[model samples]
Each structure stands twice: as structure tokens, then as C-alpha cells.
Target: MPELLYWLDLFGVVVFAFSGALMAGRYQLDPFGVVVLSAVTAIGGGTIRDVILDTQVFWIKNPLYLYVILLTAILTIVLIRCPKRIPKRFLLIADAFGLALFAVLGTQKAMALGAPISVSIVMGTLTGVAGGMIRDVICNVIPLILRQEIYATAAILGGGLYVFFNYLGWSENFSIIFAILGALKLRLAAIYWQVSLPAFQIIEKNDV
Candidate 1:
């Protein structure tokens, strides 16, 4: 289980790093700025999760993750220099994959640490969104979670389903797979169909 989680973490880091690099490219940031953003987008959520959980930060403990982020950043820069620009949709897809993987992984970690289901779900959602939130803030854009689209909503639902499957005596691998797929499907559907939750609005009244 630990080995599987390690690989999944690396995968999530790479994908998230790509998304961050894409944003840096869009803004025409220098190479150092690109790598900095990639590192933040790759590990920001996991760092927060570990801090809140009082666990060792994963990347600090395993410097391999940092190496992976550095390699991913370099690859992204190389891709950026290609004749074709990276598609905007690719960023969304990568973000969705990261969201799904982190959601399940966070929930599983919290559960393993004896947290209750509710707290586990919240941790999962936070793990899924934190990196992207930081990325957007640094990029001076509205965070995707704050957008009308079902971002955190997908993570929440995925986490809930993970707990549900665990309660049903499902295998850990099965539960994780189900949660990731569920979250990814919902996110992709939302993106493809432009589905979004209604925005909050305030009305103004003039008094005589």
C-alpha cells in the first residue's frame, strides 16, 4: 500500500507540475519562476495536509518527489519551446487527474491515521484543491474551486464514495480506484459540458 501511494503521489506531482508550468508559460514567466510555480503547484496541497495532520511532510521526507518535480518542470519547459503550444484543455485534464488521485489518497491516509469519516472527507477535499488554489493565487487568477464549475464538489463526492466503499468491505485498491474514477469522470463531464453550479448573487435596493 505504501509503495502504491508513493507512485500515485509521484504521478500527481508530475501532472500538477505540468499544469503549473502551463500557467507560467501563459504568463511568460522566466525559467526560475516556472520551476518555483511547478514546485508549489506540485506539493502545496500535500504540504498543507501533512502539516494539519501532524505528519511528516512527504516531499521533505522523500526528496525523490522534489527530483520528480524538477524533472517535470524541465520537461514542461522543453514542451513549451516546441512549435505547438500546449492546449488549455490539457491543463484542465491534468488538474482533474491530480484532483482525483489526491482526493482518494488523502482520504485513505486520514483514515489510516484513525481520523473519522467526516474529517477524512474534508482532508481529501483540501488535499485535492490546495495546490491549485495556491497556483491560481500566485498567478493572479481566481481559484478554480471558487469558480462556478464543480471542482471541490467532485473531490467531496469522491471522498464520500471512498468511505462508503470502505464501509461496504470493498478492497482498498477497489475503493481507491472507484473514488479516483468517479472524481475524474465528474470533473471531465463538467468541463466538456460547461456544467457549473449557480453563482451567488446579491441584489441592491434603492430606498425612497
Candidate 2:
């Protein structure tokens, strides 16, 4: 289980790093900016999570994740010089995959720390969105989770499903896989359908 989580964590880092690099390229950022943004987008959430949980940061304990992010960013710069040519949906898909992986991984780690179920879910959602939020803010864009999209909801649902599956005595792999797919599918469906969450509207009474 530890080994499985380690590989998934690295994979998540790669996906997010690549996504960040692409974003930088779309904005015509320099190579250094690409690396900077990629690193933040790859590590921001985990950093916050570790600090909040009072644990050693994952990349600090094992610098291999940092190396992975650097390599992924370099590769994206080399192989995809023209990120503008790539469809926006490609980036969204990559973000969805990264979000799904992190959601489950975060919940698992929080649970391992003996966090309560609700706290675990909240941490999982934060793990999924915090990095993206930072990246978007750096680029002066509205964060997806802050928008009326189904971004955070996807992470919450994914984390909740993992918890539920575990309570069902399901296999470890089954729970993780199910949670990742559930989140990814929901996010992709929302993107493809241009679905927006329903907003509440209430009448305001004028006290004139």
C-alpha cells in the first residue's frame, strides 16, 4: 500500500507540473517562470497539508518528487513548445487526473494520521484544489474551485466515496481506484457539458 501510494503521488506531481508548465507556456512565460509555477502547482497543496497536519513535507523527506517536477516541466517545455496549439480541454483533463489522484491520496494520508472522517475529507479537498488555486492566482485568473464549477465538489465526493468504500470493508485498491475514477468522471463530464453549479437567488426587500 505504501509503495502504491508513493507511485501515485509521483504521478500526481508529474501531471500537475505538466499542467503548470502548459499554463506558463500559454501565457508565454520564460523557462524560469515555467519551473517556478510548475513547482508551486505541484507542491503547494501538499505543503499546506503537511504544515497543517504538523508533519514533514513529502518532498522534503524525499526530494525525488521535486526532481520529478523539474524533469516534467523541462520535458513539457521541450516537447510542447507551442502550448497554445493544444486544446484547452487537454489541460483540463490533466488537471482532473491530478485532482483525482491527490484527493484519494490526501484522504488516505489524513486517515493514516487518525484524522476524523470529515476532517480527512476537507483535507482531501484542499489537497486537490490548493495548488490549482495558487497557480491560477499567480496567473491572475479566477480559481476553478472559486468559480461556479463542480471542481471542489468532485474532490469532496471522491474523498467521501473512498471513506464509504473503506467502511464497506472493500479492498484497499478498490477503494482508491473507485474514488479516483469517480472524481475524474465527474470533472470531465462537467467540463464537456459546460455544466455550472446552480446558484441561489433570493429577493432583497428594500426598506425604503
Candidate 3:
């Protein structure tokens, strides 16, 4: 189970790092900046999760995470020579995949660490979205969750489902698969239908 989760984490990191590099390149950032953004976007959430959970930082313990992020950024720089807007579309898809993968991985990690179901769901949401949130802050834009993306909501729902299935005595493999699929479908549906959460608003004193 541990080994399988490790491999899955790698897959999620590569997708996220690629998407981050693509976003940084679109901003016309310098090569160093591109690498920085990619690293932050790929592992920042995991770092936060580890710190909050009092676990050794995952990427620090596994240098492969850093290696993958750097490799992705370098490859992106080499392949993207046209300097057009192509990265934007690719990044959207990659982001969806990253969100799904991270949500599942995070929930599993929390469960392994003996967190309660609710805490695990929060961890999942953070792990799924924090990287992108940091990426957006670095890029000087509002985070996707703060917008109408329904991004964190999808992660939370996926994590909740994983816990629910596990409580019902399902296999870990099946539970993880279900969680990933749930997150992926929810995110894609939101994107396809342009579904979004309503923005928070406050009534004016005079109106009230």
C-alpha cells in the first residue's frame, strides 16, 4: 500500500509540476522563476500538510519530488519554443488531474497517519489546492478556489467519499480509485458546464 501510494504521488507530482511550468512560461517568467514556481506548485501543499500533521516533510524525505519538478520545468522550457498561448489549455487539464490525484493521496496519507475522517478531508482539500493557491499568489492572481472553480469543494467531496467507503470495509485500492474518479468527474463537470459557486457578498448597512 505504501509503495503504491508513493508511485501515485510521483504521477501526481509530475502532472502538477508540468502544469506549473506551463503557467510560469506563459507569464514570460525567467528560467529560474519558472523553476521556482514549478517547485512551489508541485510540493508546497505537501510541505504544508506535513508541517500541520507533524510528519517529516514528504519532499524532503523523498528527493525524487524535487527532481521531478525540476525535470518537468526543464523539459517544458525545451519543448515550448513557439512562445504562444498553448500552455494555458494544457495546464487546465493538468490541473484537473493534479487536483484529483492529490485529493486521493492526501486522504490516504491522513488515514495512514490515524487522522479522523473530517481531518482527513481537510488535509485532502489542502493538499489538492494549496499548491495551486501558492502558484496563483506568486503569479499575482486570485486562487482558483477563491474564484468559482469549485476546486476545493471537489477535493473535499472526494476525500469524504474515500472515508465513507473505507468505513464500509472496502479495499484500500478501490477506495483510492473511487476518490480519484469522483474528484476528476466533479471538476470536469464544473468546467464543462461552467458551474461555479456563488461569490460571498455582504449587504450594505443602508439596504439592511
Candidate-wise lDDT, in order: 0.89, 0.88, 0.85
Clash totals, every prediction: 0, 0, 0
TM-score of 1: 0.94
Per-model root-mean-square deviation over C-alphas: 1.7, 1.9, 2.0
Most lDDT-accurate candidate: 1
lDDT of 3 at 137: 87
How do all the candidates rank in terms of TM-score, highest first?
Answer: 1, 2, 3
* Prediction 2 global C-alpha lDDT: 0.88
TM-score of 3: 0.92
Which residue pairs show collisions in model 3? none
Sort by lDDT, best first: 1, 2, 3
Q: On TM-score, who's better, 1 or 2?
A: 1
**Residue 206 of model 3, lDDT score:** 71
Return whichever of 2 and 3 wins on lDDT.
Answer: 2
Using all chains and alpha carbons, the TM-scores for the candidates as numbered come to 0.94, 0.93, 0.92
